[model samples]
Target: MSDDPKQVLRYPQVQAEELADWRFFLMRLHARFRTGSFVRGLELVTRIAEAAEAADHHPDVVLTYPHVDVDLHSHDVQGVTSRDVALARRISEIAAELGVEAAPREVSTLELALDVPDAAEVQPFWRAVLAYEDHGEWPEVTDPGGRNNTLWFQEAPGATGEAQQRFHLDIVVPREVAEERVDAAVAAGGTLVTDEHAPAFWILADAHGNKVCVCTADGREASGE
Candidate 1:
């Protein structure tokens, strides 16, 4: 293990070719593997559990009939770190041993965002209604079981009028995948609202002007914006 397992690694620091199977999105590492059958997926999951137990670091795993999804992050540091990178490598190796191929491009996470004049005032209501738990220092709520999409409150102050869309989605995907999605959306009649936050996020609007953001972890730590 590294001397500083808790040291958070920036997106650039962890983007080596060995991690091609994984994607950095929203401060975590995500990967998906096609297992072809539920039995094979369960076998991979069992190996992952053994590896995680040995390393004393665990990842979130989900098994389905044809795929196994894994999400890795150092929860204590609230970000990806050397620990996650090492564990991700181990899991990838385990998947390879099981003849499971990775589908990196298919790994993505969705989050809901609510624009409000007073995030502090509105956050409690949503948290309670959704039965979600508070996470990090942000006014965000997440499913306690990690099944549903996370909900984050964006304080837009005076921007919450009837003219503005109060809710939108933040789709976190790989940097290259995000660009591809943006292109596809534009081809399908969606408009690019702004790339002012490119790589970190791109604001896009539908034909009716409803908005969503395609996001990645690139340059987020450097810009700190």
Candidate 2:
């Protein structure tokens, strides 16, 4: 939640329908122009405003003492549309020409830490099931994505809760590749938890007893789009 009215105006989700017809997207560009001068801040604002005006797309610019936050969304569409993306890309190019360093986009990864009574048993089961190589020390399992997507199992000493498996993994693969991967996992001793009916994501479990899913990319696309 942001108190900024401009931010609210720029990100209304109801406008997503308007976005579908649009050909661009929104982007936020930020930078600390010069280390010491307040005048440099003013100059940066002026430059951004001029660029926006020339492009006929104005961005909501927020200037703090040392940082600037630019929110770019298409007003005509009432949300982020393809036009907004075009403007954002141009704004970034302009900022770069003016020596402003754009902020990096953020990405997310899932982290699951479960309490397995036997860490050794669970670790081996997962390694063999996913065809993951031993990374050694601390004992971790990963997909081909390597360290980027990893699963670490730690021993939970004296823990006696039933293995309800409240949390599980959603493994995704291309639709064409699904059967092959699923077959491989089954052959490697992993169990098929459910072939019941997941619209997109498939659910599975490893030999030592942790649940995971094999899904199609379309599964994620459906949820997002």
Residue pairs in candidate 2 whose N, alpha carbon or C atoms collide under 3 angstroms: 23-82, 24-81, 24-82, 24-83, 25-85, 171-213
Deviation in angstroms for 17 in model 2? 52
- Give lDDT tens digits, candidate 2, residues 28-111: 222223313456556777887887788777876656566555655555544554445555566566656767654434222354
What candidate 2 gets wrong by more than 4 Å, as runs, is 1-111, 128-131, 143-147, 157-163, 218-225
Number of clashing pairs per prediction, in order? 0, 6
| TM-score of each model, in listed order | 0.70, 0.43
Candidate 1 residue-wise lDDT, 1-225, digit = tens: 345899988877877535989999889999999999999999999999999999999999999998999999998888898899999999999988888999999999998877667666655544543446788788898988888889887777665544677566666667777787787667656678899988799887654455668788896888773
lDDT of 2 at 125: 53
Q: Per-residue lDDT for 72 in model 1?
A: 95
In the predicted model 1, the residue pairs found to clash are none
* lDDT on C-alpha atoms for all candidate structures: 0.81, 0.56
| Native-referenced Cα lDDT, model 1 | 0.81
List residue ranges in candidate 1 displaced over 4 A.
Answer: 161-225
- Residue 39, model 1: lDDT of 94
